[model samples]
Each structure stands twice: as structure tokens, then as C-alpha cells.
Target: MAQTIVCINNAGMIMQFWIEWVNDDGTQGWTQANSGDYPVDQRRSLDMDALNSQGESIPPGRLVRPHVQAVAGASIAGDRYITYTPGSGTAIYDVTGTSFNYSVTLIQS
Candidate 1:
């Protein structure tokens, strides 16, 4: 089964988000759902399977991390590393940020 992470930008400003995971080979990996900044009320979905450096599906039971950051020309606002397991169901997260404040919420589904 494939796992997904959905990000809803609730912040008043534009933002960007991504997920990270340790590959089977012990290297760092990351993936972003959108090619550009997400505006308020925007939502995007990313597959956990393609989060690795090689863009391969993550093995079952592996741990994954989520991250959210601000867009260019904006104050440095970011948060990360909410641990998650693959094969569990879709993971929905809400991202909010302002000036220097940022937050991430894992919405139970």
C-alpha cells in the first residue's frame, strides 16, 4: 500500500513544505509536493513512496518525517520532524506561519 502526506497551508503567507526520511542505505532524503510556494488555503499531497534520494517507495514500517517552511523573501519560518509510519493511512497536516512564527499540525483521519 502507498502512504501519502497532505499539506494544507493555513498561514496568511505563502509557504512550502516537504517530507524527509532516512533511506534504506542510511542517507538523507526529501520530497516536496509542489513546485512553487503554496498560498493560503492551498493544499497539496505527496507520496511517501517517492521521498527517498532515489525516489523509490519506502519499505513498510519505515519511519518518515514531515517539514514545512516559508517562501522566499519571507521571514525564516519553518518546522519539522514529526515522526510517522508508512502503510498507516493518509496523513494530513495543517501548516500555519506568520513573520517568525510557524506551526505544523497532524490532522487525525
Candidate 2:
């Protein structure tokens, strides 16, 4: 399929990117990195390709069920309830449970 490509920003500058991972036990986690240091584009392209390949098996732009925990004592790391969700238009996150800290990274499909 020919996808309509658009530039989110024309100017090239250092940006922060969050990389998420899923463990063997089905738990999710993420870490933050500076785009200036790594090839963020490569990672984003891979992630987007994985999502797009999902096709219609799952609803696009919907949060993956069973939100997982962040790193140990994520609150101390300044991240709480770390989760991944897909959406477009205006980005928004519905945070719940303050008992745990959260650092959410939304990926649009």
C-alpha cells in the first residue's frame, strides 16, 4: 500500500526517544534515549513496520491491553505506569493509579 508520508518536523534537531521492550514473562518496560546519540529513525521505522504489518488483526491506534510495569522502583527513576498505546491526531494519555509512577510513550500506527 502507498502510504501518505509527512514530515513531523522539517528541522533536524536532537530529540528524546523512548524504547520499549517486552520480557519473556510478558512484562513491558522502556528506557529513554537521546536521538542525537542513536539512529532513532532506524528504530522508529522498525517499530512502525511491525505495527503496520499487524494489518487488521488488531485495531490501529488502540492501547495494547494489560499495561505492564516500568523498571524496578520506576517512581525513583521518575517514570510511573510506563505503557505503550497507539493513536493519532492530538496525543492524549489516560493515567490511572498514582500508587505507581508512570512514563508513557505513545506510538501511532
Candidate 3:
């Protein structure tokens, strides 16, 4: 796996994403269903990499596949990364959006 940063730009919205926890146990959690609510321990941001298959970055006018999106609470904006001890199982993420414009960044952890 590799460290990466993804920048997404659309019509009027722009997003910068960094994947901090990419453990084997990371899975897609739930929305209203309790089956997918897992508490995270800490919040941290990782760097971006292009050669890394485990990492993703997006920019405007790009197309991307649907994956678990990291979102903040209503009062907050954009996605956030959380870190915690490895769990007995993988952490699940929600699958949303099919296409995106992605710009990527690579950095050392």
C-alpha cells in the first residue's frame, strides 16, 4: 500500500482527501443502520502518492469509481480521517458517487 492525497473539483464544489487508515480490516459501514457504525480513535491526514495503488486523488473533470466517502458532521464540512487501533474486523465505508475528477499527490509518511 502507498500514501496518497486526492483533490476533487466539480462544478461548484472542491474537495481534498487524504486516506490515513487503509488497514485490511477497513470495510464499509452503515448510514441509518447500526450495522456500520464503528467508533474511530484518532484523526490524522496522510500524504498522497501516484504510484500507490492503495491511495486515491481526484480533481475537477475526472471520472472515478464508487468507494466509501469520508464525510464530516452537519456542522462540519469536507471529509476527515480518523486513526485507531486495528480492529478484529475491517472498517466499512459507504459507497457513493460513480464518477469524479481526481488530482493526486504523493508524499512520504
Candidate 4:
């Protein structure tokens, strides 16, 4: 299988690619959900081959079960959410599967 590919851009500049973890249930417990440096660009591809190649079951998009930290302020574990640090225009890409493709447009704040 081919490795999942992702392309990100920001104001016509390739804003470093990165992955972010989010709360699966859309709950507020997870800091990564709506806080922190959202859509963080850490320069890495969200690799799913580990579970894909071996035919192991993997969540399609967001995890169905909420990630729990169970310590201090609990939080979700794993990549529960994936985001693209889009340029002024937009970021687009195909997911390993059809269900994963997404895009985010930057709005001047």
C-alpha cells in the first residue's frame, strides 16, 4: 500500500507539516480539543501504515472512544484529531482512505 500523503500550505508558503491530537467525543476535557497551538505544524506525516499494512483495525477518522488521561487533568491519548495548517487559501489532500480527507482555511483574527 502507498503511504498516506498530505500537503499543507499557508499564504502560498508551505507551513511546516505536522499532526495534532484532539478529543474524539468533542468534549472539553482534552486540552488539545480547542486550546493550545491548534493545528500545530510540527513537520511530520500522520502515518497510518502501522495499522494499515498489517490489516489491523484502525479508526476511520476521529476515534469513537474518548481518550482518557486519568491523571491530574485527564486528556485524550493518540491522534484523536488531525488538522492542516492551511495558508490564506486552503490545504487539501487525500486520506489513506476516503473518510480522512479534510481541509481548513485560515481566517484573519
Candidate 5:
């Protein structure tokens, strides 16, 4: 994991995350579902559609705090670490792809 600051200058906050592993499996599976909705997991995902100050693209690689998204009713924005924690029981990815993998992390309530 990357050494991260909880927030831009957060002294302390119960920050948690839920993660999703998106594989290029090209098939529908449990992993394809909204696993982030699982309350048990400290679920969090990046708001891929979020815009920047200049309305420019701000993906995870760009570190968009305001764009860091969580499930509905969650009160959180982006911070520093992009975590890797998916809901339990089931595997992270539903299908196995012959291609690379992408991770989606979100905030937890």
C-alpha cells in the first residue's frame, strides 16, 4: 500500500474504503454487481465521472479528492491512498480475464 495522508491535512478521521477489482473477463458475474453497496465492507470507489476545477478529466491517477466517491449517503471525498479492499466472502473479481486488471476504491460510511 502507498503511504498516504488521510486527507489534505486531516488530523484524524475514521476513513475507510471499499474496493472493486475490475478484470477484463468479458463476462457477467458476481463481481460485476454493485459490491460497493455491501455495508459490511468499508467500501469506497473513485468517482470516475467527476470533473475538475477546469472541467478537465480527473481520474484516480490524477488524485481528485472531491471526486472520490462512496456509496449513497456517504460523507467523504478523496484523500491520499487508493486502497485495495473488496467486500468479503466472494472473490474480488467475478471473472478471470486474459487481460490486465483495474481497481476501484471508494469511501465507506
Candidate 6:
């Protein structure tokens, strides 16, 4: 069972997004899916297994946070902390906003 994070950007602007793992020791780390900024209407799929920190995978039943921001040098526009158990399935997050009032929607499947 593979876990994945799917981000759909409909914010009408270029946006940057990533997933951070909440380590057992309260440390935060990101994955390779944080490549760069994403254009409007773009959809990105990030495999949770891509997370690697000191040769460690995301522990089961851990918390994974998703972050999204405008690429135009602005602060984080939207974010959500989700408690995810590895091997569960796919988690889909939709980014939608207008005038910096951004919001993230978690679509359960």
C-alpha cells in the first residue's frame, strides 16, 4: 500500500507547495516533491515514500503537514496539518484562494 499526497492548485497564480513530516522528536523535514513553484491549474502528486530523513521513512500513524504559498514573495498562504497513517491510501488537498485569502481542502477517499 503506497501513500501519496496530491495537490491541485486553483489559486489563479503560481504557487509553491510541499509536505513536511513531523518526526518523533518534533523535527520537521520535507521530501523531494518540494522541487519548485507550481503554475496555476497544475496538479502535483507526491509519493509519501519519497520522504527520507537520515535513512528513515515516515513512521506509521504520524502527522504530515501540507503547505502552500504564493510564488510572488509572500508568506505561506495556506497550510493544514493532517494525521496520516502510512499505507492507508491517498490524501488529496485542493488549494483555492482569492486575494491572499487562501484555503486548503482535504478530500477524503
Per lDDT, the best of the predicted structures is 6
Error of 5 at 102 (Å): 26
Better of 2 and 6 by TM-score: 6
Write one digit per residue (lDDT tens) for candidate 3, span 27-54: 4321121112222332223232222323
Question: Could you give candidate 2's per-residue lDDT for residues 30-99 as a string of tens digits?
Answer: 4322122221122211232244464423223323322222222232121222223333232222222322
* Alpha-carbon lDDT of model 2: 0.28
Minimum summed lDDT over a 10-residue window in model 5 is located at 90-99
Cα lDDT of model 5 by residue, 5-109, tens digit: 121111122233322222345321111112132223233333233212224332233222222123333343233324222221111111111112212222322
Q: Report the CA-based lDDT of candidate 4 relative to the real structure.
A: 0.28
Give all candidates' CA lDDT scores: 0.61, 0.28, 0.26, 0.28, 0.25, 0.65
The Cα error of candidate 1 at residue 5, in Å, is 0.4
Model 3 residue 29 CA deviation in Å: 11
Candidate 6: minimum summed lDDT over ten consecutive residues — where? Answer: 72-81
Off by over 4 Å in 3: 27-109
Runs off by more than 4 Å, candidate 1: 22-28, 32-35, 50-54, 73-88
* TM-scores vs. true structure, each candidate: 0.65, 0.22, 0.21, 0.25, 0.20, 0.71
| Model 5 alpha-carbon miss at residue 87, Å | 24
Clashes of each: 0, 5, 28, 5, 10, 0
User: Order the candidates by TM-score, highest first — what do you get?
Assistant: 6, 1, 4, 2, 3, 5
Sort by lDDT, best first: 6, 1, 2, 4, 3, 5
| Best of the two (1, 2) by lDDT | 1
User: Candidate 6, 78: how far from true, in Å?
Assistant: 5.9
Total backbone clashes of model 6?
Answer: 0
Cα deviation of 23, candidate 2, in Å: 2.3
Please give the distance, in angstroms, between residue 19's alpha carbon in candidate 4 and its true position after superposition. Answer: 2.4
**Decoy 3 TM-score against native:** 0.21
